[model samples]
Target: MCASFIVAAHIEQNLSIRKTAAIFSVSKSSVQKLVKQQKIEGNLEPKPRGKPRYSHLNNSTASLREIVAAHPDATLLELCELFGQNTGNWVGRTAMCNALQKLGLNRQKNSEK
Candidate 1:
């Protein structure tokens, strides 16, 4: 942000884009982009680009942990079903597996020694 402000100030002072980039140790394209953004938004500060990500499991972590604790031998599909029954919202098998993995509760079948 400081770099952006300096770039904008230099450009406002009639400094060449190339010279501003050279002084700032940034790419010429970066200077150009910042100048363009300043022209468009009247500021060089970057704006958030996309919607924030949301997780269906955010509210179900405790329920998931309890379910896994109660059913250590449950399959991924079974866990997904149980989560749906508990939360009233069904999640995909891969999503449930990923959520479980994120919670450090990966379930794997026992292999013979």
Candidate 2:
């Protein structure tokens, strides 16, 4: 998508790289890089786009799921604490929450009776 936007930016839309980057909330260098890549490689896939998987998380996903399944009401902080205890190193609350979300373990708000 970013590549399409960049390639079409000049003749089709007459939008500058800086303007396109600002509107897209991306770096101008990204737009320029993608434009160059499209011209050279004819492909637009983002390389190294997101966080690399943590080996700890991959190796212990089963244990983490077990802990959460045993305690569905646990808050993210609580999960992090438990994870740290199990792994001997702390997992960030954000990472824990993301993992739980991916695992279908979201904490929905409970309605009071």
Candidate 3:
């Protein structure tokens, strides 16, 4: 959306770099650089940046909840294998345990279990 807005401001709206940046609530030099790049490449696609998402939580939540509910006493490694087999996702043991912990299932100390 930011890329689209920047492209629209520069191409469709025919706005100057400074004016485009001001209108888009971004830095003037930012707009100037984008405009320069667009003019050079004739492209406006936004580059992908930032850390990549590891898990697809949207679809995994139901499976995770079911697994946790079915086996609250399951170990971290057990949960990881179960999730991987059932949902076709190989989650790290630590990550799976952390997720379970977030859902109120923490590993008990040696004496507690």
Tell me the spans in candidate 2 whose CA falls farther than 4 Å from its real position.
1-55
Query: Mind giving the per-residue lDDT tens digits that candidate 2 earns over 1-113?
Result: 44686668743788888888887788889888888888787887767878877745656779998888888788889988988898787888888877777777767868899
Q: Write the per-residue lDDT of candidate 1 for residues 4-89, one digit (tens) a residue.
A: 66665676788988888887788889888887887788876567899986667877889889999999999889988988898898
lDDT of 3 by residue, 25-63 (tens): 888888777777788878766667998777543357778
**For model 1, what is the alpha-carbon lDDT of residue 40?**
86
Off by over 4 Å in 3: 1-32, 36-49, 109-113
Instruction: Report the Cα lDDT for candidate 3.
Output: 0.76
TM-score of model 3 (CA atoms): 0.48
Window of ten residues with lowest summed lDDT in model 3: 104-113
Ranking by TM-score: 1, 2, 3
Error of 2 at 67 (Å): 0.9
- Which candidate wins on lDDT? 1
Worst 10 residues of 2 by lDDT: 2-11
Evaluate residue 91 in candidate 2 and report its C-alpha lDDT on the 0 to 100 scale.
83
